[model samples]
Target: MELLSALFLVILTFLVVTAFYHKHLMAEIPPGFIQRKKLCFYHYLLNFGFVLAKTSEKLGLASEIHVIRTIMNTVPPLKDKHLFIKDVRFEKIKVRIYQPKIPTTGQRRGVLYFHGGVGQFGSIRAYERTCCYYARKSDSVIVSVGYRLAPEYPYPTQFEDCLAATIHFMRTAEDYGVDPTRVITCGDSSGGTLAAAVAQAMVNRKDLPKLRAQILIYPFLQAVDFNLPSYQQNKTFPILTREQILLLGLKYLNKDVTLLNVLFEGAHIPEDFQLKYQKWLSPDNIPEEFKPRGYKPGKIIHPLSDELHALTMPTFDPVFSPLIAEDTVIAQLPEAFILTCEFDVLRDDGLLYKKRLEDHGIRVTWCHLEQGFHGIVFLAPLGRIVSFQSGNKGIKQIIDFLKSI
Candidate 1:
């Protein structure tokens, strides 16, 4: 009788979980998505895992779900016969270096990559396949910086670690057979944030070799206004949602999650500050084609609390939000390669930055992946099960850009 009772309970629990998934998640798929059975199953599993992570956090049994989600994506490194991989420490930060084993005439271009997890979870191991791809395909030396994550190190720590590692690599490029003048900084998601910010921070440094370019892949450039069109259109989108973005931001800042709604309402930023930065961050900067999906203009919200102001002010700084850097800085920034995905919540961030770069007379190569979503690039060639065809196209575009510059 007890065995029969246990079997019945397990079946009932499975049915309940299936019902919840189909009801809440299956209904939220955005229009024009590739409706493959595998794709839907992948998203369903991810949503189910997120739900478990959320329950763990609420029960005080684990860290933030954002970090957990990133951790879940970690996989063992694949063996690359053409690349010589090594792990090293620059100051206190860890980094993985991938060098092509094949012969070259002289020094190769160096790529300094910062992996993205909203500053909390990614590791050098997590980005091994990505760095390997670039090192092998582009024939460049890749240095994947393993910066300290948040909820422990907090804001500015991740930046400092990345900057230190970048400086170390730039200064020691010759030892690694890397051309000092051809080194470029590259990153995706929040790592793109670090790459952009680090590149800007290096502009005035006379000692280090100048960076040849910066490659930003669907970076989250600003936290000042979350009501941008991409945010609205992809609010309920999978993998990275509007709520998850704010949640990750709060986790990075080690701030209260209660501010998510207020920040979404644009209450944290002062009206005057918003007006000042609107020229670059406004919906007007985004091309009209990107808006056919959906977008509503954001209204100014009065400053709410001084506490919220103090907590969120770091986002206004150039180091934190490179998108708001002054015109002069934008003019001096390295030639840029930016990739934006149509279904990404941070798509407009790339669009706005592209406009700013062009306005400053900077050379820009922009690639838009219409069928791609945020984090798709990282899935390239992994498999049709986890990888999108658009991801392969995006990787090819990046490799071509690297070859050009």
Candidate 2:
């Protein structure tokens, strides 16, 4: 046993060392001229590889997470640059504060950034590059929240952690040289879900200031109808598969997997509920411009048994579907900036939310990445060889919006 344990430790150390070497070498390569398209694929695999590496102990896969952890954190916090980063604790939650290092004549906006990882993976380390970029480019004090993951703490824990952190920051913005009046919540994927949810929840709270805006980057707003156009079009597409998506949802909810088919076919939703959300959740709501890539509306099917529907009803819970928030709640929410990727499965989710926000007369700044795919933003410029123009363009749009508000 002792010899076997020692062998495992040696293998782990070797993997970490080799990964750091690759990342170090990749960083030295010049951007733009590097084989960016190929590097895009590399980062795509690396993102999942990080998960495999950390879970290799339980699933015996491999450990790329250690490699990313080493390199992503290699650029020590640039305390001398545009942002002043300091670790602070509020409401029992830990956060990294990114205040602009340069003096501002008046208070600046604050961005409450939540990192994406499907609620099971990812951390501040994985998002270190993104948060750092925002802090520097937008000249806004950014607070990146490291929320808890799932299959560990179960549902609501991640949401609660983010809510507490965001509210605390809003109430105490003056302390960080930020104007509470202009605070906004921003996130991607699962993080986007949190951003939207928090915005909706705090819209009418007279006790605290209203959110100036919400920036959702292809957020996963609902598990209710997984049959949206983007889901069907990108179901088998690389990065996030349809079946793999269902698996992720189940894992996130800590629910039973025995009746997975019922959830996928839209069975958990009742007839009335489907009819109500259909106005917003259906493919008909998708603009024709998006259909140039080919999207056929899904055929409506009959409802399932009450037992089956009851089992999967949590998908419609406001915690999971912020789109279902009361219209009164929606109307009170602040302005928003939404970005949708053409090849992402969650594209329809963002489109639907945009219409809802707009229908309620809220201002929304929308940006679309015509050729970008799911998780493409994280790969924009992670290393020297793989930054694509589309990814960079999309990222610039985000920074530009932040600067605008």
Tens-digit lDDT string for candidate 2 (185-207) = 99998899999998988877888
Question: Which pairs of residues collide in candidate 2?
Answer: 53-62, 53-63
TM-score of each predicted structure versus truth: 0.94, 0.84
Model 2: residue 273 alpha-carbon error in angstroms? 0.7
Backbone clashes (count) for model 1:
0
Error of 1 at 293 (Å): 1.8
Model 1 per-residue lDDT at 191: 93
Model 1: per-residue Cα lDDT over 1-405, one tens digit each: 999999999999998987786667656666567744445566677666767777878888885545464655567676899999998898898888999999999989999999988987878877788889999999999999989877678798999998999899888999999999999999999999999999899988898777899999999898888988889998887678889888888878877899888888888888778889989888888889888777888887885578878888877888778999988788889999999988788998999999999999999999999887888898884656678888889989999999887
| Model 1: lDDT of residue 269 | 85
Q: Which runs in model 1 stand beyond 4 Å of their true positions?
A: 57-70
